[model samples]
Target: MITTRVVKILYVLALIPISLFSLLMAVYGLAWIDDSAAFGYLLLLASPFVWLFQVFATRIVLEFVINQFKISEYLRAIKDKG
Candidate 1:
């Protein structure tokens, strides 16, 4: 759950580009902006894959942090002691 929380946070953080591009898309759709449509569409198409990569990447990073920070060891110790 903890790792998942971290992953969710990181995943949401990773969505910044998508959100920004969504806003840009909205603007383009409304004809308030014209020059950014292609770029917006590019990001729109790429963002899901990018976020998927971010989720996996965040998991890897969190796994490293758990080991490097000894959080998993502490958890195991607690479970054993209990």
Candidate 2:
């Protein structure tokens, strides 16, 4: 469970690249950029959905890990008591 929290923190930290890339792209207009570059710039500019998606992904992963850890701990306690 503790490790899972650390993982979640790392996931959040991963967003930093996305944010920085987006800001950089936004500073330079996509119109003058090449198509692929423009696309990347646009993607960065329009990445609110990406951020939201990451949030949901992190939540689901954390929830599953926490639940699994709790279940395993519970089972271990039961086995120890028995």
Candidate 3:
């Protein structure tokens, strides 16, 4: 079984890419501001929402994975008892 410290590290690591992606979107949107203000503003405004949604989704997935591991561990304990 993996240690809790490792799982915490992995969870934090997973968030890094998501944060980078959101930053890129904001940068791209800023770059486009001069050419198309509306589109640029749209992207800028949407970036945060997108980040929030992605984070929420990622959290759900991680929780599911953690739950699965816990379930398996519990099952193993049960089997051993029997």
For this target, which candidate reaches the highest lDDT against the unseen true structure? 3
Give the CA lDDT, 0 to 100, for residue 34 in model 1. Answer: 58
Candidate 2, poorest ten consecutive residues by summed lDDT: 24-33
* 1-82: candidate 1 lDDT, tens digit per residue: 4665775676678667655665555555445225567665665565556656756766677667657557766888899999
Structural similarity to truth (TM-score) of each candidate = 0.40, 0.55, 0.86
Instruction: After superposing candidate 1 on the true structure, give the runs of residues whose Cα lies further than 4 Å from its correct spot.
Output: 1-36, 69-82
Error of 1 at 39 (Å): 1.6
Sorted on TM-score, highest at the top, how do the candidates line up?
A: 3, 2, 1
Summarize candidate 3's per-residue lDDT along 7-77 as a digit string, tens digits: 67877998899899999999999999999999999999999999999988877887788888899999999
Q: Cα RMSDs of all predictions?
A: 6.0, 4.1, 1.5
> In model 1, which range of ten residues has the least summed lDDT?
25-34
The TM-score of predicted model 2 comes to: 0.55
Show pairs that collide, candidate 2: none
Residue range 31-56, candidate 2, lDDT tens digits: 53565776766665665666566667
